[model samples]
Target: MYLMSKGLWGAIAGDETTSEAKEQQAHAAIVLNLSDSQLMHVIDSATAREAWGRLARFHHSHDMANRLWLKEKFASFKYAASSMSGHVMELEDLVMKMKRANCGPSEEDVCAVLLRSLPASFESLVQAFRMSVASFSFSDLVSKLIAEEVRQNEAARVEDATALYAGKRKGKQYPKKQQVRRAKGPSGTCYNCGKVGHYARDCRSGRGPREQQHDQSNVAFHASEGFASDSWVMDSGASAHMCKDRDAFEEYEEVHHARSISSAKSNVKLNVIGHGTVKLRVWTGHAWIDARLENTLHVQDLSKNLFSLTAAAARGMTVEITRNECVVKRGGTPVATGRKQGFLLYLNADYGTECHMAEDDTELWHRRLGHVSYGTLNATVKDGRIKGATMKTNVACDVCATSKQVRKSFKTSEEDAETRESSRSDVVVCSDVLGPITPASKSGFSYAVTFILMKSRYVTVYPLRKKSDVASAFERFYQDVKTTSGTKIKVLRSDNGGEYRNETMNSFCKAKFIKQEFTVPYNPEQNGMAERMNRTLVEMTRCMLKESGLDKSYWCEALMTAADIRNILPNASNKNSSPHEMVFKKVPRIDHMRVFGAQCYAHVAKEKRKKLDDSGVRCFFLGYEKDQKAYRLLNADDGSIVISRSVTFAEHSVTKASKSRDTQVFDVIEEDESVEASLTDDEDIPAPVTEEELRTPPLRAQNSSHHGPSV
Candidate 1:
């Protein structure tokens, strides 16, 4: 449209008679295609002429058009372009003419002309038009403008509807003026004067001088006398009353007595409450009041005003309210109630008043009672002769005698033995053999012997089947003890048992370079180490067996378990250092230990588990594994034992009978000699027991059968 308009004007201004000019006019006519009447009106209007000049200037200089002219022209062209209704079409037209005269149009110049022609209502439309023209093709520019106009109208309509519902506007109209309401003031009767219209401070009928004076005087009087010389001043908000110090209470007693006589008396009783080693009941004439007693008391009004009255009162008074209550009483009457507030007490008083009151009360009370004075008295003796001399003796009591008792001395032993430090490596191993195939253990093997290291005091035990298996027992003992002590057996100390003197044992020790240290035959105490270890192992085994309430068959388990415990437990012979520490250089953690024969819960591993399992297996903790981080467990249901690292112990799960018993026994023994023989043979060593060896008879026949036969 702009091109057609500009082209027609250009043709008219140039050669009107030429065919090229006529052709341009014809092209403009076709593009314009306005009706004759509309064209005539457009041409006759002076506004159109002014609009053309404005458009021309906007295209050349890019200045703004008059706002009034833009508004009127937009109103006239509302139907032609809704978006351009509030815009000055003449300014835009002039820009188009200049652009057509120059060849290509400048977008910035066109935007400036359009913006200048835009009225208030078309501001958004003009912005939309500029953006649309810049971003879209020329053909889409007009369509986008029209669409933006429709969107703007719809948005305005929705806004008006929302405002109407919110009671902010009626329809799409806005009011020229708005009114606001003012806030109201508070209303009520005044507390000071009981006036309905005013507040307390503004009350006209003021308080009287006499009433005010009385209040002031009352405050002053209370400030001066409310807290007695001995009385503790406390906040009124406190819930319970407390008299902690005896001195505070004593001072209070003196002042209270004086006040009791001076006031409108009705026998007011004050019971001080407190708790300590002993309960105290202080009865003074005052009423029971509610207050709280703090553990610490601060007397801001006095220097060194705090005292441990609870302890003093406990030592000084004796009275009862209720067993749980810390109450003071006069005569047999109850005066105070509640839990005893025991501890220190604090009070505020003048130094002079405290001393004078305490002294006067002390003198008066003594005179009244006619009791002997503590220090001195002013009483004069008749004829300068003191009569009825009073004597106080400081005699020692039962506690003093008991505490000061001394024990009689005894002579020291004359025997002196060599003393020297020795490691396990330097020790001659020794042990006593004592056990029998008693009652046949669950594994069908029952025998136990104590094995001790002379240097390190480390010990072990081996269970056997028969005395004849002594050779085999020695092999088993060597395997266990050697691995534990990590040392070669250089010497073997033992009683002169036939087992130790056997050719096979002597030959084996000689071959191994071990010096067999044997005591004289029938004189066992010479091998005191083996003898003592034997006694110790027997004692431990007895304890274990008694504690477990099981038959002597499990004696092997008890022996092994006891040996392990003893090895770890501190021994006096080793300067209270356990064998484990002497060897391992570290204190073993005993936290995971469980009592022998204690019930234990063993977790079922995936390999051991089957589908539909409901519960875990129950077992007894035998002992710890020496080689691995595992525990030796004995399943009671099955005599077979298994080593596991995962198990929960129920230390308190001992049965009634087991608890009553004093001993417990849980033993483990290698049941098959053939297996042991095979192992020893595989190591290129002689079978621990040869068939011929098994045929040996007992050296000493079970004579009296004392504790069965000592192995």
Candidate 2:
């Protein structure tokens, strides 16, 4: 059309002009449009008609060779670039060349060729075109193709804006408007490199392909920078709370469905592997509150953790967004708070050290929760009573196995009652002595007396130096029960041991108006409450000592810890409520509990040390103090007990050297004499002997008694 408008068609159509100047004008116009190679075919021509004919015959001749070459070129045409109009124009030019050579295809064939030449990303659209019964003209196909191309580009831009806005609201930073304007070209900004002159699909430095899908779905990205493992951003537009940290979920269920979240890069889809509840320590302005987010999706490829306000609202949480803050509340209590920065609301939540326990197995919680029964631990977590605890799989705990082993029960005697239920705290207290333990404690104590309240099952254990000291221990326990519960003990039940059957214990019980009940001789099961408690405490002590690599001398500390932990755990006879709760009337908080005998560092006060001295002393965690809000620690260097509120623990570390200890047994040897006359020197004390010694010949009894009261 352009050549005809310029009156240059006359030269190519072989029109003979009478005016020489007009003919030359037409020839010059055609010559100006020809390339150097085309000009070479007509270089020797003397007239416009001759030159036009020579060029036509060489380029688009009606010959078999030219027809086959044009056919092959048209069939092999492929669209690889981003521009749809350019590709269509190239294909149309090939069709026009074929027509000039007298071998052009039909319009329907041209339409088919055009669809086939398009890239694989347009497969869906191409299929729709092919499935149509009505045939399309070449021009109609071109219009539809161009329109679809425009629609796709528009959809991609909208998706990009949607993703950018969503991510910006999730604390993602993008280029400022002024910066974008300065950097972008007349076309637009590239999403890949944030640069000018090209689209993301055409960018050279893109991380991956950014091809648009034919369906034109909206893409959303949580963030564009990188993975934010520790922090969370509040996203209102998100459908679910998405997290990349799988370990952060306290309860999780794997997803079997093919679920995914589209990213800002359209080709990238973040797969959702699971969903679960995440327990967070949400920081309010003044303090931290325990918050659990349910149905949080775990997407391993998510760039940032996102908390969905919509999801939170669905789960009964109230989200209030003001000009500068977002406050989240559940049941009128503030659970989480976020501060607005620019357009985003970033939550002040602590993933905590629990998130760092990615490799932590079930045994870690078993140790941290004070070696509670595995069934109880799992039930607590499953019931949602315990937060920030996960049990992915079971792991064998040798300490628990060895310590919790028990012998089969013997048949109950006819005199023993089937049930002994107490009506109230301190109404009936069960007391029993558990020693002559083989190795004496560091404080030179060899026996422990346990007193358990029959009602609450709350236990108190006191280490004693001698069996006679049981009276003093019971006196101290009596005063404590009176002082704490303001109740008088009505009955004291114990076995027929001399410690409790003696005149001193009888007189103390009579003065307090407490009835003293003794079990039959050799039937310890009659005082089952205290007898069972004694065995429990001993087992706990053994486990803690064995796992901690500490010496048997620390048995007293371990026993005390065991009693403290037992008080907080659910009692079998207490209807699943902890003994502590039964007595104290409040639920005990076990979040502060740590693994027993874990390696720790206790801080030293400034006044207690010199300027050059170390600020902290390495220690071993013993247990908690009953009265004070402090942790009891044993100084590793000096073997001294240190009480401090500020202590850091390394629960994963263990002292390999002290893990094993040879089992030893000792006998309390005594001559026929009074208790006072049995007091002897240190050399007279019997030494611990191995099992092999029992197989050897028995040694003759010595006439001289050698002892300093054997422990």
Candidate 3:
């Protein structure tokens, strides 16, 4: 038919006398000879000549069916170790097949399909590749895949070695507690219940102690009253050698089925991350002795690391406590010893003065240390920082997604070294403005400025009227620090923001003999103290707001409260010393503290309300008033904020059932396109003052009528 269209009808018929009808018949014969699959590819063609050309070009006589098959194969291809290269080849083959079918994928599409076929373990690698994204090519991708495959094989080898050598030996199996001592009758029949083949175990009438099945329930993590991070405390009370630190284990196994540890009151299902030996170095009166703690329980929701005397005894080691110290001896020779501290014995490790966390185990160690910053563990948790921390960065932890407001402040190796070499506390201060935080704070302040002394990690936050107020805030902060410490500030570090580099700031710094270290144009990382502190404060504000089920207007109270907490949190500079103690030379008084956002009854003075009237007004504990001996409370009844020292708190009454959490309410500011109106006078401010302080209204709530303190 194509020959006939090109006027080759007579020539194609092998005779000049051949008619157009004969040429058409020849074309029809060729079309009919094609397979059904090939016919389908050219089924839409108008003429036999057109059909023949279409079939030859696209599916190569069956291109449509082949294209469909190839597309399905590309979509369904998955990775297999035995044929990873083969899988890649298969994808390439599909590309070629489609190209022949005249419907080939683009270069980018080809690369994407190749990556998509890799196994789950390649997920992080692929994400990392895309994230940094220096270059992307098929060759580069295949090279990376091959390299990853090699690395995985090497890791597998290492893991196998660890399993062979470090893995714990399975213990001897004992008879089940439910197993009956002996069959009741010689015939193996129980007369008690008249059941055959079931003697005493299930016999209800038989006199034997029945073992009760233990039920494991999940427990939420609570802040324990007394617990250390890295160190272990000797305890006769502990049922096992329990450790909360996930990174403490040299090896770990995840728990699938529910398992638990039982207490007199409740049974907490074991999270059972995995277990391995902890290398324990005990300093005796003479020297340091090394002992390995095997079969340790790496469970969650634990505060302190407990070394059980019974577990040690079971492991063929003898524990002797004499002369205010505990000694562990194996085969009558002392292997480990701990000096007594109160009721518990303590053994401080010689982890040395270096980076404690390893490069690879950063995330695991982060989880182990209870999702707090490396330096912020309380009294009971040990500083398990091992030597030779090889500078791992940006390790993400799921537990820390909500909990880590302070974690970001800890400097990386380069930053830490630079900070130490370049700056000193009180001598240099880093200050930055945080926001025009939506739904302006009750004080009508939309922005906050943070001031952090480089030396102590001590912070002071001031509510800002506008960005220009930063200079005045700094003046106040500088004066306060100068008066207290009697040390002149040598430097002021900040970004090249207008607030910091202004004429007022320059004059103040000049008069104070402070060298201003302005970070190059747009880099906030240089003024990390101010930026990180500001971010941490905001995050804490958000978390508290969400937790309290309060509206966003109370960000001021939350920010102020965060500032107070930050001051009291231990600084990395000193051992067991907080910013409060470092600057003020005294432990911050925490006894006066009430739960932030807890429901409380603030005492109403007799002068304000009648004797027969309510003596107390239900309020939300806002925070403590600065330099005052009273709590800032938001009256639930009238929405007025009052300062009162006399308040009764129902801290435990705020249960999960009673509190309705709007999870999505976090980051409450809605995005809008209006030029600056969305930021300044946005609808986020629930404008009209309402009865519930925790409800919508912003600036007007705290200004409402409040009962005066008793005269």
TM-score of every candidate: 0.34, 0.47, 0.39
Off by over 4 Å in 3: 1-377, 380-416, 419-422, 655-711
2 or 3, which is superior by lDDT? 2
Better of 1 and 2 by lDDT: 2
lDDT score of residue 68 within candidate 2: 97
> Is candidate 1 or 2 superior in TM-score?
2
The per-model lDDT (C-alpha) reads 0.38, 0.60, 0.53
lDDT of 2 by residue, 1-711 (tens): 445676666666766653677677767655544433355666677777788777666766788998999999988877643245435545766787899989999887787788888765467778988898886666556555544543443333321222211211122234433323222323576656667777544556634343333212122343421112346767654546777655467677887755555553334556677788876767877797667778788766555677766556556777776656778888977778997543346788764332123334456667865565665565556544454467543457777777656554555344343355323345788787767776887878787777777777777767777889888777876876676666578888887778888888889999999998887765555666665665566656677777777787777777777666667666445546766676667666554567888887787876778977886798888877544556888898888889876565666445532547633212222221121211111101111100111112111111111111000
Write model 3 residue lDDT over 542-614, tens digit each, in one string.
6566666676777777777766655655644445665666666665543344456778767676677875787
Error of 2 at 302 (Å): 29
- Residues 579-696 of candidate 1 have per-residue lDDT tens digits of 6666656554433444666667565654567765623577776665544456777776675686765465544334322334422233223222111110111111000101111222
What is the overall TM-score of model 2 with all chains considered together?
Answer: 0.47
Question: Cα lDDT of model 2 overall?
Answer: 0.60
Off by over 4 Å in 2: 1-337, 340-347, 350-361, 382-384, 388-395, 410-417, 422-425, 655-711
Please name the candidate that would achieve the greatest lDDT relative to the true structure. Answer: 2
